[model samples]
Target: MQNSFVKVPLWLFERVVGFLLALPIPIYSSAVYGLVTNMRGLPHMLGMYIRGLYYRQKLGLMEPNVFIDQGVFFAYPQGVELKEFSYIDKNVLVMSKTAKVGRRVHIAPRVFISGGGDFEIENYACIATNSNIITSTEVLKDGARCSGPMVSADQRRVFRGKVLIKKDAFIGANATLLPGVTIETGAVVGAGVTAAKSTEPWGVYVGERAQRVGTRDSVLCPDN
Candidate 1:
């Protein structure tokens, strides 16, 4: 039961938003996207709902009942896939060519997901606010690097890998998951941790370079 203040059908509105979302990425990724969705009250609600519906149609995959919040900054979203009951919070920047987001996933506000390769997030995963999942890094040749769109070919480098998060994983706020790392099922990353490797299943990890501390099942099933 979607409550709408406006007369337009949700589907119709979705289609309209889809059209806007399909505009050339590099140009309208920020401005038009923000302009349409940054309003308050009914307009904001409408914007959020319409954006979700629009992405569902335009993206590689998107399931039902997904709430995409206002001001979600998605770059190259054509290859991103989202599953059922997933919620992407406001102002989260997902810059991925092929990112697979799974069922019941909740991405908190201002998370940065940058994937040049395939980044896969499994079911029941929560990415907390200000976390970063980076699947690629710049490869500098001869100590040369490119800052903007204009740079010599020799200064350009794009190294890519996959980031895998198993089911029931929680990425803490401001955590950084580096390229080619996997967070196993039921693993908990403490806030401000920077994980550079795969976590043990159900393990609690914390610190700048995260290490396993305890098993999640101990707390989850205390009597067991």
Candidate 2:
């Protein structure tokens, strides 16, 4: 049987008291009166305070100076370990159970990072605008087809994989990184390139198959 006389924590009791005290008073003469107008801002303000002050401060995972822009949405199991001078830009969606972001990592606007496992961003890694870093595969829409024709008329070919943008790797704007693809360290993926495979480290990748178009100075290393 469940305990009937369960004791509530002091902090929780204090929060309840504070919320009741902050309740708005009706001012208008109508039936709804000030209840509608005043109560509208109450939820928004409380939500902001809880997320911006209470949860963030209590969690202690992110650094003090980390900048979380307005209107940014963080989903469940959100874990962010950001080093100094790292900023999460506006309208970004960072949804991960465990996400480790290194120092000076610049994440551009409207980015989405979601996965059940860990999502890591090494130091000095830059994630460009409208880029998606997802671990799971999403089913394609009906009648959706690949750029090339299928080998069999009755069957449909689907391209799915994991996406990894390594340290010092730059993902250009509007680039779609497929599953199981690793953008090697110091490599530059050209704009609008859909990388379907692991790119050579320190090489410039462009086009549909993301072929190595230009060789960087670092590619001259013995590993190349």
Candidate 3:
């Protein structure tokens, strides 16, 4: 009876703490650290609940059922769309805008997605661990110097484009999908590959510049 009594206040205390702490979380990142990342380590499912509350308040409550594991950082939550049954695993850094993540999408741990707010992961698409999807990169001209992030856009050459991963496409581990690249439906981008262009439907790409290795039969694919 004494242990039960002790558990009640502990639970209530965490609830109150979560509620109060979430009020200070804004819609964007902070200079000192990440506001979303600061919301980490809240003790399991309660942490997901509190993180959901923060996102719901800041990002208009995108989805109630999406599971965002601890240690994940969101640089811009205002531009993200979290659909149902989506699982964003641990330590994933989402520093992109216009991140349209469709239903049942699985973004694995340590996946870094950054861009010009024009990236889309359609329904049932799975991005494996340690993959990078970047949309905007600084281009170096012969006479111009490479500058840092704090520098103004006019001072540097920047290239921004759209990245789209269509329905049922699978991105293998440690892959890098650059600007203007589209992983078409049912295509598989193999591990350690870097792509700079769009892929064909049911195509298997395996090299640095997306060299076509083989093709998968589209008839055997499944959709949930």
Candidate 4:
């Protein structure tokens, strides 16, 4: 099937809208942030839609049904994609261009996802509040290097890889998913865990360096 959305490049926006637009973007974002942070209920929902409309026009691809809550900041939204029915909660910072959120996905408040590589959250996936997902990291190759748009070009070398969260996966609160890791379908990543490796489908993982404690089916049918 043909892709339904467009991924606008950062350069393209600059070229089309000119550099003047850059100066006011942060200010506009801040105003929206403030507005969203202060309001709640119907007012907050209205603000979300308003901001979402502006973002969809300025950024690359944001589907019509997507809901972007207040205080959500994106450094480079050009490469981002928010599929249908997905909602981003408050105070989320997405600093990467390669972030893709799938349908019906719920990203709770204070979630931070960053890096230059692909960060994909599949349909029906939920990432709890304060979760950190990194798909890009700085390494000392020729010297200390950083990978991202905001960093100086020569100062740091940034390495990027794909971080995949498959369908039906549940990443608990404050969990950290590192670069190149995959949380497979129906997998449960326990709270406060740091996942450094790929997980098995339907597995239940916990701890700092997450280890499989059980399967999802076992959790659902404990008597079996």
Candidate 5:
């Protein structure tokens, strides 16, 4: 009699679980993953799987085998395309429009990228922690009245420019790549540097304003 009672509850529990599992992934994806984009504290493997589905179906364009870690936030994911084999570390924020993260790109933790359409990180690029890639900003020069997003459209004079991290480029921690600048293929932006202009291919930049301190040997960047 005791064995029969135990089997009854187990059977009911299995049926309930089966019913839940029968539901579409979209419903679960939206209900849970949509509401909690970060999904922090979830198992790493599970979070990656759920986020992969969410990105492909609802969030934005993500190629196969992309690893998007927890705590990442996309302010404008509709216009972003995450390329194949890319990895985004935790807590990174991408606020760009029409941004393309190229193949095998690895973005480290707490990096912030914001710009308009045409912003891109080319294949094999690595962005270190806390880097800021600001591709567009208000024209706050020569006593101009136009400035910032808060002002009216007519009053706002935007300084829009394209920022690109080319193939095999490496941006160091706390570095800031300014509007309209491109870190060319194999270039390295050193830690704490502020890049104000485009870098030459294979150059290594350092200091307050981008200065080519040396050249990164192309041999190390074999695929570049």
Candidate 6:
């Protein structure tokens, strides 16, 4: 019998590319900072342009109007797809071997969406600032440790499961969405809530354990 599994060196390549692309920032800043003062917009545009260029040059593809801010780290750009009108805010870190995002999704600042498995977010979904969506099993540091309020042995499976936020779902600020969880269409997840299980469609969820507080006809849209 022959071995059936084929091992691809994707992790090594990701690290190497990340390192090479990040190397020029320090050098460029050191050389140009002295000559340019009050140049705020230029640096941001240049960083965005460089990030876009690196994504295209290294990965061979990137959709238009996908804004990547400075210091945003991605494990595999090829596995990530941002549709039209999608905005990834500053300092956001996304790591997914396979992740698909739909159009007009607003990912706020300091958000972390990571998983080894695939995670999908439908169009018009609003993810508030500092929200965390943990998708794969590797993301959990300890599978056996379960001491916290939200901790359980089953929580370890979150990293392995696929997370789906349906269209028009609103994830409020500082919320933690665990694995295998699906936010149904028009659902509203309140701020600072940790959802360990799936939520019903068109309902308002709150609290640490994320219980259903109320029912609404439609999902609560984020403030513009």
* Model 4 RMSD, rounded to 1 decimal: 8.6
lDDT of 1: 0.78
Residue-wise C-alpha lDDT for candidate 6, range 23-128, written one tens digit per residue: 4477764443222221222236766554554554434245666666655656776777777767777667877666777888878889998756667888889899
Candidate 2 stretches greater than 4 Å from native: 1-55, 58-60, 138-162, 218-224
lDDT per model, in order?
Answer: 0.78, 0.60, 0.79, 0.79, 0.79, 0.71
Arrange candidates by TM-score, descending: 5, 3, 1, 4, 6, 2
Minimal lDDT window, size 10, model 3: 27-36
* Candidate 5 per-residue lDDT over residues 1-224, each given as its tens digit: 25978989875764564345334676784566444466652345866765665566544577878888887877777788888999988888887776789999999989988755357899998999999989777776655565466677676667778889999899999999888898899899999999988999999988997888898888454553
The TM-score of predicted model 2 comes to 0.59
- Cα misplacement distance, residue 212 of candidate 5 (Å): 0.7
In candidate 4, where is summed lDDT lowest over 10 consecutive residues? 14-23
Give the total clashing residue pairs for model 6.
5
Give residue 26's error in model 2 in angstroms: 22
Worst 10 residues of 2 by lDDT: 33-42
Please say which candidate is ahead in TM-score: 4 or 5: 5
Cα distance off (Å), candidate 6, residue 17? 17
- TM-score of every prediction relative to native: 0.78, 0.59, 0.79, 0.75, 0.80, 0.67
Q: Candidate 3: how large is its RMSD?
A: 5.9
Task: Encode model 2's per-residue lDDT on 64-159: one tens digit a residue.
Answer: 445554445455423657666666665667665566776677887788876544466766678888977764443456765444343343344444
Runs off by more than 4 Å, candidate 3: 1-21, 25-43, 219-223
Pairs that collide, model 4: 145-156, 145-157, 146-156, 146-157
Model 1 alpha-carbon miss at residue 43, Å? 12
The superposed Cα distance between candidate 6 and the true structure at residue 167, in angstroms, equals: 0.9
